[model samples]
Target: MKRSTPQEAPEVQVETSGQLPPHAAGYARDKVRAVLGQAPEPVLFARVRLARTANPAVERPVTAQANVDVNGRPARAHVAGHTATEAVDLLQDRLTEQLARLAQHWEARRGRMPVPGSHEWRHGSEPTHRPDYYSRPVEERQIVRHKSFSLVRESPDEAVFELESMDYAFHLFTDADSGEDSVLYRSGPTGYRLAQVHSRPHPAGNVAVPLTVSELPAPRMTVAEAQQRLEATGFPFVFFADAGTGRGNVLYHRYDGHYGLITPAE
Candidate 1:
């Protein structure tokens, strides 16, 4: 008779950029493993990136980002600090919190109460410092990235869960109830707001989370128009219905100071 042991999952893959310390990659891998190892669900894949800025003026020169797939769900976290060690430490904490919130969402779906001592998660006030955008003139910037995909159809609460766990500033999806393309984002420190292609009042009782629907309708504009408006308004992003297709699209500023567009797949 023979006994066999189950193989353990592989260590997290770590990537580095810029002039990082030699031990930076290994340290990040260990830190990421420490966090994902305690995940409530199986971690299918995990990758961490550590980057350093050469500019000394940047307060937080070291940035760390992690993307992980827990079972079938995706979660992500990004953080920055003065040093690689600090950045990795912050990443671990943020990733752990994200996974916990995700696990809570799963528990609720199963009609089970949240674990003991677990409280409702709220948006933190910490600012994530991304790469500084070059001072390129808006007129010179071009639409460098265009992403097209099928939007998920889900409830507001589910969308919120995904948005926070994935560390997205805004999430574009199809509203399950209204069947309209919608964007969900943080309204304030503790609340969320929803914007729909056809603006209409949403019944508060239908949504379980703290949410408010936008009263103004999404503007219909072409990509070029949206880009001009974004430049004029200095808004982080613009959500609008495409003038040509009548589908929702998002025009936003990338970290590189270029325009990026997101549209639903045809």
Candidate 2:
């Protein structure tokens, strides 16, 4: 596992039109007042903008956020909501309650609770229902098929685009020369990881490779890092890992060894 010092998120610049929305602007005002231990008087509200997850077709509810300029500095929040109205209400209520409480909390603990932001969680144990669209008729199914096929021996990048185009969470491919096997998979917060097969892959192919390829544990990184690392490694001849999410983050289960760090690959 590669460890690097953590860096905080960059500040957001809030644009303005010499006005603020009633709900959006008030929410910001409330947050500042919360910390000041008084009603909003000197504070000036700049702007309120509505932002949401890019994809709307997915069944999962989208999250909304707000960026407000309090006094002359910037204060922001990324609260949860499925709709604009719901998001506005959430911001209103949260700002109203917390701003006043901020001063109290800070005084008591010498800090304000870390403002909430987007987060994702992973699950444990095996899935009871292994749903399959591969078998389901295409007319009724979203996924047409997960046809098992062979790929020309090459780097993992060639295979990654294949998965992205097909919208696959993972892929099994042939390695150059050594005829070794590996899997490119995505699970949980860890977008994707490379697994070089050091051992046998799942035999049935009826489900996700039941077998772990590498003994190394999963890595803590983003999809981009995973691909970069695999490219750097020159496709070592070994069994690949199965990437998935857990309580911590996306992890990779090695073919034989304990799942280790799957950190961002430079």
Candidate 3:
């Protein structure tokens, strides 16, 4: 009888949009493979997208984004640069950092001590450069993206870990303790703040990390009303409870200046 060999996992597929260099896709594939190849957990699915804006006024027209499912947990990174190669380089760096942090998180969750010098958590090192917002006037901006899904239910600590590892400015989830729709975001360089549909004071000992609950509850309004407030206030984003469904919703400004909305699925 002949011995059979195990099949190797398929290579991650890279996708490109807008006008990119002919070699952009291949270059991105090589970079992604190099990073995901060394992931601590098995990569079940991975996708890379590279897009370029045709507008000349944008300083960083090239944008690169990557999403990877590592052992059932998802990790994501998004970055922008002046060129395709530069963007891919930044993407690789960001992905590597996120994965390292995620590995440390998993180790802690499993009651294992993280390897010394394996990773570092620095709030000051978070990426500051973001793609320029669209030059279009705010009044002309429209809601270009709307995402609806069942919000995850997790502890505040778990939500903070996901927010950092996924490079999200804000994370929306259901509070496991209070059973309320909540949004978690960075408060300052070192602390985090939580806003919920029905705001309530939380005991300081409830969360291990430095977290504060918002005194003001999430505003109740329709999508249209939220849009108007966003335009009037020029806030980076708005978190509210949908008046009709009473579910948590986030209306934020995209890098392109267009509005993007995230809401819980009914």
Q: Please give each candidate's TM-score.
A: 0.90, 0.27, 0.87
Q: Which ten residues in a row have the lowest lDDT in candidate 3?
A: 1-10
Model 1 scores a C-alpha lDDT of 0.82
Candidate 2: worst-modelled 10 consecutive residues by lDDT: 125-134
Where is model 1 more than 4 Å wrong at Cα? 1-9, 114-119, 126-135
Global lDDT of each candidate: 0.82, 0.36, 0.82
Ranking by lDDT: 3, 1, 2
Number of the top-ranking candidate, with lDDT as the measure: 3
Local lDDT at 187 for model 1: 81
Prediction 3 global C-alpha lDDT: 0.82
Give me candidate 1's TM-score against the actual structure: 0.90
Worst 10 residues of 1 by lDDT: 1-10
Candidate 2: C-alpha RMSD after superposition: 17.4
- Backbone steric clashes in candidate 3, count: 0
Q: How many backbone clashes does candidate 2 have?
A: 27
